[model samples]
Target chain A: MSSANSDTPTRILESTLALLEAPGGKLPTMSDIAKAAGVSRQAVYLHYPSRTDVLIAATRYQDQMLDMDTALAPSRTAANGRERLDAFVTAWCNHVPKIHGVARAIMALTSTDAEAKAAWDIRMTDLREGCAAAVAALARDGTLPDSMDQAKATDLLWALLSIRNWENLTQTCGWEQSRYAMTIRAMAVATLTQDTGPLTDALACPEPPA
Target chain B: MSSANSDTPTRILESTLALLEAPGGKLPTMSDIAKAAGVSRQAVYLHYPSRTDVLIAATRYQDQMLDMDTALAPSRTAANGRERLDAFVTAWCNHVPKIHGVARAIMALTSTDAEAKAAWDIRMTDLREGCAAAVAALARDGTLPDSMDQAKATDLLWALLSIRNWENLTQTCGWEQSRYAMTIRAMAVATLTQDTGPLTDALACPEPPA
Candidate 1:
């Protein structure tokens, strides 16, 4: 995209996202957004005539940044499939904060607005598939033992990626995001490779090679 | 407490929770809830003078019900310490959906409501400490390897208990709460044990165990 055109969408999306993050964006008018962005009222309408249109574009922009697939692809080079999955999770830890208010907005607004949920659903479905695929890749490569079921592995991956757990660890527990990323990466490695034993105790134990 | 005193508190709290939950709760007036519960408006004020107070109390009530320590305690039988932790996680999965909205509300409030966040923070802080204690207890009993540190173990546990993750798995991925609970329980037990290679594989690989 041309620089001016690129800047135009970024500016518009940034302004709209600020409004959405504030209390009750539902009542904000287009003029409010234009004023917020220092753009002409007419110019605001030139790109997105309605608040819905503005939000739609803004959502797309947010997803482009926070999408899990992009986050995981770079980390896929780790030796085993398990390591790649850990990298995918590390990518998520690194990526989530950039999309402020988006996850919360998705959960709250999706109930009354299917459009909102669809946006979130699209992103999350892609993320889960990416995680599952990363895991399957490991298995196919003979990096993981053959006895494990892919379905179970995928479900386990999703459970580890809990939204409550993620925010709680960062905001409440005050871990640096890197440490947070390390913890999940370790947990994922543990769950996929650990043989039968006391599961919770095993997770809490100091990191040891399998 | 006397029926005339605390009983009214229960009614008001329940009504406030009910009003806050539905399409109607977004902007409910005290009059709306009084009518819903057939209680006098004074009853609400007598217990909670404002919506904020009611919200605080109602949320606390929800927390006690899903407090991970309590729900998971029953499941952690006289098994090895790690096995107990596994059962605890399984029970916790069963407990989350009952308190889902309360969780989402904490993460993404529409307003900069300091009181709500402070109240919520205290609750999460308590959960963090409880998790640390549980891990400590295992280590003390020699069920977990002695190398486990309470602080890091607690952080790891918080990551595992993510609220966003819970919502994504149950709401987005379509797993029954029980299945979600079991997988987590299994992962929890395996996460910190001696037999970690398989668990690590599980985290990384899409395929099932050997």
Candidate 2:
């Protein structure tokens, strides 16, 4: 393939992100995106058959630019289930702010737009797999509570770490990013671990002095 | 005031709910809603100065139709903090499905419409107050964990019972309504209570026979 052809897709994806992240939260049309990318409508169509395909690809491209895999390395390589849980929470919570713009754009489209819903479902399913892996790690170490099986544990963890939950805490409740990460990690440990020691330790927030 | 004049607001609110809860999830314009109510566009504006006012009032009308105050009585009159927690969770979960249509409509508008965002915020703020009351009950009973203050516990519980979480569990994960309520109640008890006994009991999902 010509270098120009390869570069065209990159330009399109970058332009998609730029438009999505712009103020007002309005969804851009395909022609608008093509215009922004300095590409013809036909060229945009040649690269992506539909707007949905390009929008999903743009999110993936944003992830690549942000080095999402490297950010998740610690969780992937954790020594044990407990460490994995902590690392995963830290990594995911920290990552939420970075992806907030694109994530918000996609989420805004989800209710009325089928393709947007599909794109979102794909990403969430992937996130669920990550939750499952963390639960599996805990089960492997026998630290998972006997009350719930791995699947149930995974569901609880996944629901607990939802992007909406993060948005509610940080945006609605005005929690600082670091505090959200800490509190959520602590909540996860308290909720899923078999050991009471971590539960108490995790739940302990320092009191403000009079 | 004449009976006709007094009845216009009720008619307008009911028509707004009907349109919002209709199939297609398309936002209804003032004219569409006025047409549905057999009133002139001027009548709608007379009752509610703007679309936002009418939309907010429509949600409030829905709550009245569903007897929301009666539904919340159990939580309001709970014998203790733990009872309040269980009752509140039960009441809210049961109510979600009933209002899902209108809730989804308003949520869809929130990203692009500032007025819609304000309406959603008003309802969520009310919901958060319920969460705060439940947390306050726990603190009163000295059953709240020492690790977090009442505000923090309220934030956690409010996030836990988000409508989006309900959608994810039921619509996405295919959890039964009964199971979602039961499990979420258990999770609330497990996460915020000082007692570990309820934690184990709440987390226990009956194992299927091999």
Candidate 3:
């Protein structure tokens, strides 16, 4: 705590992520986080009030990235349509390790809170549009076959951006972040175009299961 | 308290799910769930003694279907690879909507929770094996290109099964279950066979304001 206390809010966020995962133990109390941040719980209270506040703040911290409509903006209009779609998928998958449990919390929020709904709605709408454009760009260039439907193509992109499935890969199958990213880009490129290399044999195992 | 009382545990589960999303909603007191479930606290405890117990039971209720190796059996050797993969995706999407938030919770359980991890691990291993066989069969029937990577292919399948993304469709986008199910099948068949049709128009719609 003493080594790094430059930003109190950042410290609290770091501590919160630690507590959220609790690799070492249970979550720290506000007093505990405040002490670590070299501030009073009252100071912590200035930023957040209760444990739920901390959780939701931590949640918002996790969600802030998803809300970014400008991520990888340069690639949105890339010359190659497949590359643009690949760029979007790759960028989204890179956010996985950061937002792991946050997806579940957001899922819970969807049926429970209005603010949560608004936040997620903004992000989803942006993604739907971003995905549609990226894939549509590819179709125009004839990189992807011209016969494809763009709306459903965006759905395909959305499916590839799934946090739940990425969490399943890391948590259940123990795939590292790099492999997950690779899988995402490969699938995006393949699904949007004629790359069956990713669609057909990407999930198989030549070695016997353990 | 009186709307539905067909099963006490089911009622408690519904109440627990509601409470889990509410602010400051602890594991939920038996009395709290009992009141909501329209049953006695003792009745709630008879089914689950602790929050951990409740979570496990809730998890099991959803995982029971994923635990099955039944629907995937036909896929291991189907003559029509497209039909085979279609069945695989159909079984998965049908099973997903019913379990809903339950899968979201199951995924939150860590590697340390032996019961939860064991169940998740078994399901994933089974899914991997199932997908492998299906991919091999699809290859045999010439439905997929020869160079398709099987392991990567399964990753594509799991990506489509993403719970949070699926929930986003119904909960946020106001999509009906049937339409989403159709999306699942279309995504699978189209990606596997590289069929475009209208799906290539993924970028037809203009971007909504972020």
Which candidate leads in lDDT? 2
lDDT of 1 by residue, A1-210 (tens): 112344665787777777776744343467887876778888888887566567667777766755655556676767767567767777776776666455655555554566766876776666678668777876776654344566666766766665556666666576666666666766676555433444344334324221
* Ten contiguous residues minimizing lDDT sum, candidate 3 chain B: B201-210
Categorize the docking of model 2. medium
Kept native contacts, fraction for each prediction:
0.36, 0.59, 0.20
Docking class of 1: acceptable
Q: Estimate every model's Cα lDDT from 0 to 1.
A: 0.62, 0.84, 0.62
Question: Which CAPRI tier for candidate 3?
Answer: incorrect
Where is model 1 chain B poorest over a 10-residue stretch in terms of lDDT? B201-210
> Per-residue alpha-carbon lDDT of model 3 for A92-179, expressed as tens digits?
7776666655544454454445566566566567667877888778878876644346665676577667666776676656667777
Runs in model 2 lying further than 4 Å from the true structure: A1-9, A22-54, A205-210, B1-57, B205-210
Among residues 3 or more apart in sequence or in different chains, the pairs in candidate 2 whose N, CA or C atoms overlap within 3 Å are: none
- lDDT for each residue of candidate 1 in B1-210, tens digit (9 for 90 to 100): 112344667867666666666642354567876765568888778878676667777788766645665565664453566655665555556666766665555544433466766876776676566566567666766655444566666666656665656766666566666656655555555554444345544333222221
> Please, what is the TM-score per model?
0.72, 0.84, 0.69
Which has the higher TM-score value, candidate number 2 or candidate number 3?
2
For model 2, residues B1-210, the per-residue Cα lDDT tens digits are: 122353878988877787877766576889998997889999899979888778778887888889988999999999999999999989999999889878987888788778888889988998999999999999999988777789889998999999999988887787778778888888788778877665666777544322
Residue-by-residue lDDT tens digits, candidate 2, A1-210: 112454888889888888887866477889988998888988999999888788888898888889977888999999999999999988999999878878987888787678888889988998899899999999999988778788878888888889999999988888888778888888888777877765656876544322
Which scores better on TM-score, 1 or 3? 1
Q: CA RMSD for every model?
A: 6.3, 4.8, 6.5
Tell how far residue B29 is off in model 3, in angstroms. 5.9
